[model samples]
Target: MKPNIYVVPRWSGTIHSDWYDWLAEQVEARWQVPLRRLEMPHWQTPRVEEALAFLSEQVPGLDEGTFFIGHSVGCQSILRFLHQKLTPESTSPNVGGLLFVAGWLEVDEPWDTVEPWLDRGTLDLRSVRERVLHKRVLISDNDPFTSDFARNKYLWETRLGADVTLYSGQRHFNQKTAPEVLSALREMVEPAN
Candidate 1:
């Protein structure tokens, strides 16, 4: 069966915004992949637990054929979910891959909304790494919300063992379309030998 693709939106983000809709269309048309853009609850004032619960309920079958594309805080939600759900004794299957856009370990602004996430500490990379088959992070060189590019890139690389890509000026990546993201998704699903 084709892999199930889930797109987790950013804080205060909508499934209708950015390149989400375009990605869904392209994935279905090109690869026959089923991509579902999840609408996170309480997006304006997001809580980690809430987001995790929502994802658990939404995506109950996180098997080897499952893939995730997360934006900003939604990236955190996906990582945290993996960290929380996967265990050596658990019957849950390992996930296929993860593609995080504008993902971050730390942020420059919006302390009020981001403080809870920052306070949650780092993810259990050992377990998460073992469970996830592929991991990639897409970042912007000039993102206002995430200024410390080097640090963010370092964490995603060293901790999660993810391939980090730095784009020139895709600030926050809230654009109408993202061909780079689509290309990355294609690579993840159809990796080059």
Candidate 2:
């Protein structure tokens, strides 16, 4: 059976399922798999725990074949959920692979209102690194959230053991027509399937 694909949206973004519909179509066409765009409650101003809890409930059977695509704070929430909620002995399933788009461990100034969710102390990168083997981190050179691209790149690549793909003019990758996003996710999920 083809693995299930889950696309997690960025915080405060009104994407819902539209952002990933194109990619889902591509995946369904190629591999006959299904894509689920997870919709969190209070997405406009999401809390870390709330998002994580929602994802946890949705993902009761996360095996090594399950795939994930997380953007911005959605990525942070996924990492936290994997690190805190799932462990070696836990019944919750581990993911097969993950795609992080414009994902960050921290956010910039004036956006600190969401800092409580981005707290570094609560997340564990080691667990994330150990859980998923195929990982891709996509960031834009001009992303407003990630000021230091080099540092963030090194963090995701070296720390999380993910392949970092740098893009230009893709601010937080919030566009409705994101071709690169579709391609990258396809590349990540096709091989594993």
Candidate 3:
């Protein structure tokens, strides 16, 4: 059976209509797999908490072949979830791999859209940096969020040890402007089995 693919967008509840949805559909149709776009509740203080909670519930009783694709803040949420599980000494069976697109792991990133999440004591990036995982990050060389402070380039390199694939001109890899991400995602999922 094909693995379940979950795509987590940057913010919860705000669906920006563009190439992102189209790319996700392409993956489902071409790969013959179940794909879910897990939206965050909203860009608020509780947004990450809610997204993580919703994601945790969905993982129960899952098969051993689910994969996650996260963008921007969504990528950080994925790392948070994995850390929580590891801390508990529990294991998630369904998660097979990850496709983390341009993401900011640093709290001081200069975007107001993500400012509400900053200063939260729960976001421990250093731990995520060192913990090894079987996944990859689709690093955007020109992502604006990758400023020295936000340091996406460093995060992808040191923390993720990512199989970084370069795309020439995309900022943060958001909704409207980016490459056909589904194609890269399919490549990650299909060959693993």
Q: Please report the candidate that would top lDDT against the real structure.
A: 1
Among these predicted structures, which one has the highest TM-score? Answer: 1
User: Ranking by lDDT, best first?
Assistant: 1, 2, 3
The C-alpha TM-scores of every prediction are 0.94, 0.88, 0.75
lDDT string, candidate 1, 126-184, tens digits: 77788898898999999898888988898888888999999999999999889999988
Residue 186, candidate 3: C-alpha displacement in angstroms: 2.1
Residues 1-193, candidate 3, lDDT per residue (tens digit)?
Answer: 7777777777533444345567666766787765677656654433657767977886553333666777777777777776666443445343466788775566434566566444344555443444433467776566665644235555566655666666666656655644547666666666655
Where model 1 places Cα greater than 4 Å from the true spot, the runs are: 119-121
lDDT, residue 155, model 1: 80
Q: How close to the true structure is residue 113 of candidate 2, measured as C-alpha lDDT? A: 51
Candidates in order have lDDT scores of 0.86, 0.77, 0.61
Residue pairs with backbone overlap in model 2: none
